[model samples]
Target: MALKITWRNILPGCFKAKSPTSPLEPRNQVSKTNSLQRLSLSDISNNGSFFSASDISNSLIGFGSNLHIFTLKELEMITQNFSSTNYLGEGGFGPVHKGFIDDKIRRGLEAQPVAVKLLDLDGSQGHKEWLAEVIFLGQLRHPHLVKLIGYCCEDEHRLLVYEYMARGNLENQLFRRYSITLPWLTRLKVAIGAAKGLAFLHGEEKPVIYRDFKASNILLDSDYTAKLSDFGLAKDGPEGDDTHVTTRVMGTRGYAAPEYIMTGHLTSKSDVYSFGVVLLELLTGRRTMDKNRPSREQSLVEWGRPLLKDPQKLDRIMDPRLEGQYSMEGARKAAVLAYQCLSHHPKSRPTMSNVVKALEPLLDLNDILAGSFIYMAPTEGKKDNDDVDIIGNEHEETEAEKNEHRNVSEEEEAEKKEHGRHQHRKGYRHKHRMRSFRSRAVYSDTALYRTYRTSFDNPKLQGQDIVN
Candidate 1:
């Protein structure tokens, strides 16, 4: 019988992280290679078998037969029995791990580097999330979507494995301390790729509802190509001509659409709203909600939503790292697209497909405005989601509170700028001397990839040292 997760799977909220109770050591434990070259296809594929849709899909009617299936023991072994050292990151659903299966087995099975996710054994919440991910990734297929190889359901264990992405997540690249500076062109490509993925999910034939679409969930491959991941909060929309899909409210605080938050009515436009916030992050290089910012400015969506409506303010919103390298036309078009996504009314926003069309020509640096075709007229005098106060729950800050918040943010920004300058100098030094550092020592070894530990020493390290 197929396994399923439910509220009963979740442990009490008081559960704590603990060491694994395994007698066997991990397969390997090598240090990481910082600047590795891509593995050849032959290296990636030693065996004839590999993951595909047919492997996991149900055999009848070709509904979901292409999917791959993984045994629980295989996942445990690949992830060193889910060792804490192999952890990649975590989310509302569970922690992610970086691990490898045997090259011969993978090639024979046609699998590539895979990430494993182990669900927490809490209760109803865990079950719902598990079901959500299975229902969506089990069936959805798109170039921009992350591929799920297989899953494990053994006793209390519930895990899912996916193709590994080297560049990490869009959120890390955009907002984290270890994030790299993305060029304007790359940022635009990511946006376009992400939009296309969402369009596929919300396409006419089988409209899948992605309840949580944010920067963090958008993982990047080594080449910096974006792939949408994490579907634990996803939902399939109601069928037919129904305008909206409604359910219990579930989303990140800053990215949730105003209408959805207020009315509990969801639509593909809800994802569009979150995408707008992500675009703002790409353009401004800011977090959607940062405690380090002044209270009034803590919410990036609240601060930048108004500015997005005006094309002239686009320059200020664009990431300064681009150093004015982006074409004005390109920035303007992006601003307009962002404005549409941020539309207060769900009906007023352009469909995800339409958003993809608007971005198609912008991909080329040369022909940004050459393909500018306006499909929808801008709505005038529209009421914004923040304009209405539905709950009437008043949480006011005294003048003292406001002053304290402002002071804290000012100090934080000062530190960030100071750190930025230091990093810039260090990077310059690295680039100049990097030629001499290129050796087999900098490359990935067969045994190294399988045995690397993902642990972070918390006590002596600062926040910036956590990921690297």
Candidate 2:
């Protein structure tokens, strides 16, 4: 007599041997159970043959125990039968729906909302991509990385559940015309948070290279805190002295590193370069690739890199929507840091750790401005002084003093320009004469320290908060 092996005994919670149909059950729920029955080993096996216990154990090991194996019916119920009202947004994988899971569905878990992403059968990516997301996000956890709540792998259906991000993505915030422009401080905070996420991934025992790092993949919270999302395209970094992992070139076009695009070799530096592109977007409020822009300015990196070294030209590239709210010194330093990250050679770029250190100080500049800014009332009939405020070391000046200062500064600037032109003409005949352009090297540690000291050491203003 052939020994019978029940699926209930083998897979326990994963499978039910003889599920009785209930009149109260929804039609879709009944179909889902019927689908599970078809995948049972008894139907596939010849004459109900029993399998060795070791075979069952090996198969179960691949399924992560830490992840909750959500049934298709459960997800459907939570998403209100995938109602149109619950639809969030569509991506390459599929459309995401907002869902709420209570303790009734998942015992011991708190009641909270989640974003369920159902895999599109005819989409560009399939089972392999789904499996990659489950295997990576299920294991990696960080404050700056979006949390993976659970996943469903029933029959032909595949879905992922993640913590709902309140503010959507960086791409929407940065590009949407109706959205309020993110304040300079908010942009810096987002960049630092994102860099920390990438740094975490790179510093892992077995490093992970975030092959896809674009503004769209960076999700923001209510407070404008940024979190990294979408692990489908992530790959393990090269191990043990290996420089890079050779793979098919894949990533958003404008953000892919120059070397990574030229060669299939991928490294952690590829992610660093992509971060720089997004940082540029945050700084300048420009898209990586925009056909609407002038032909020469279509590619942001190519058009912006040269301007980063020149403070006078850098202001021209800044986002006009910012309305001169950002500190000039801080913006110049950030531009220099971005230029370094976009270096032609990967090795020349700083590690994510160093990138974090560089950005931390920039945040203090905003904090100081926020805490120390004062709104002074304008004198009657003094329309010119109506909108003026003392910033940094400058004190309020009388109209006469202001005019005199402006005249002197204008005269000095004209003299310098005339002197520069004369020197250029004199050097026209000298073959080896070189004109020095300011670069990242100009941002010395001493200068940065002095800037930080001046901002942070200022006494807080005693009045109503004015700067918004």
lDDT of 1 by residue, 1-468 (tens): 212211211111112323324312211110011012111111222232222221122221133324444666677778887788777877666678877876454445664567888786752247557755655665566789998766666566778778888767887666555423566677888998898899988883547778778888888876667889878767766568887877788777778889888888888889998888788888889887788988988888778878876865665566655445455677777887888788888888888889888988876646221211111111235444332332223345545545555675676577667666332221121111111111112111222223222312111101110010
Residue lDDT tens for model 2, 30-107: 233333221122223323433433333333334322456688899999999999888877666788888999889989
Question: How many clashes would you count in candidate 2?
Answer: 0
List where candidate 1 sits over 4 angstroms from the true fold.
1-64, 103-108, 123-125, 367-468
Error of 2 at 122 (Å): 1.7
**Candidate with the greatest TM-score versus the true structure:** 2
Clashing residue pairs, backbone N/CA/C < 3 A, model 2: none
Candidate 2 TM-score to native? 0.68
RMSD of 1: 20.1
